[model samples]
Target: MKKLILPFLCIFLLVSCKNETKQGDSNSNELGTAVKDTVIVEVPKVPIEKTIKEIKEALTAKGFKTFEYVDETTKDTILMQQYFMAFLKRSAIKMQNEEESERLQKLHMEHLSKMHELGYADISGPFGDDGDISGVTIYNVPTLKMADSLAKSDPMVQAGRLEIEIHPWWAAKGIGLR
Candidate 1:
């Protein structure tokens, strides 16, 4: 029994190492020189200064602004034109009954249309019923207070059917339809 176990273990070890040895041998010629079949290309290194200059040039060419990294703690990195916007996060639980919900929806549409006409709203849409938040409305306002004021004017918010959380947001200046 001991002899049979030893032979089986030896056979397993030989089988496992057979493939690796064959692969290693194929990578070299009979003379032990790395064959032309296996090509090894080394990447050329560019100086740090030259690489940085090239990156900056590429960004400039593509109309992108570049800036140096500052210390941590704040996310203020690149200096792009900052625009104030508002995000209206609809509450997950509906406070209104069916009738109230329908009425407020109408009011909401009217209010959004008014915002669109005034060039204050960039985008607005519902987030589907499955999500924690009901919908999102992005407003192109000048200040957080202004965004809150505009949000408060919604009939749903006034009736306590929808909750509004006002936040100050900054984004790239020229985006979305004019």
Candidate 2:
């Protein structure tokens, strides 16, 4: 009975150890080679000139006044914020009369409401003298189509109070959300 028990226990231990070793080996192999090889295909790059021309034409067709700047690689995010803030401050300063201030306030409220309806959070402008006058409000709408529609419909955007600069992803590096 003792001999039988010893042999059975040895067999069980041997089987368990073999199973554990097999599991470890199989796991390593799966980790190493589980990724299936995919065919690599290279896509031809679109000519920058052609792409820019197309975008310009589309913008023009959509009734947006387009300006083409040379590829100076200016820091856009910072520059955009500064430009927006300056514009807003100048506009606010021009509003000296109570009527003008009321108009501007109404416009601001309308702009904010429109942006909210379009499902976007407003991005505030860069630093400046007064928080209200110097800060510009920015929103990223659901789609380019929606943005274009909003631009056409919104008085602020149409009057150039809210300037929308469309950028390709490649050009938008290092620009943190406001």
Question: What TM-score goes with each of the models?
Answer: 0.48, 0.30
Off by over 4 Å in 2: 1-97, 122-127, 130-134, 151-153, 157-178
| Sequence-dependent TM-score of model 1 | 0.48
lDDT of each residue in 13-116, candidate 1, tens digit only: 99987755666666666655566666679876964344445655664665444444433677644333223344455565576789878988899899988988
Q: All candidates: CA RMSD in angstroms?
A: 15.2, 11.4
lDDT of 2 at 141: 38
RMSD of 1: 15.2
lDDT of each: 0.65, 0.47
Any residue pairs clashing in model 1, and if so which? none
Best by TM-score: 1
lDDT score for residue 91 of model 1: 61
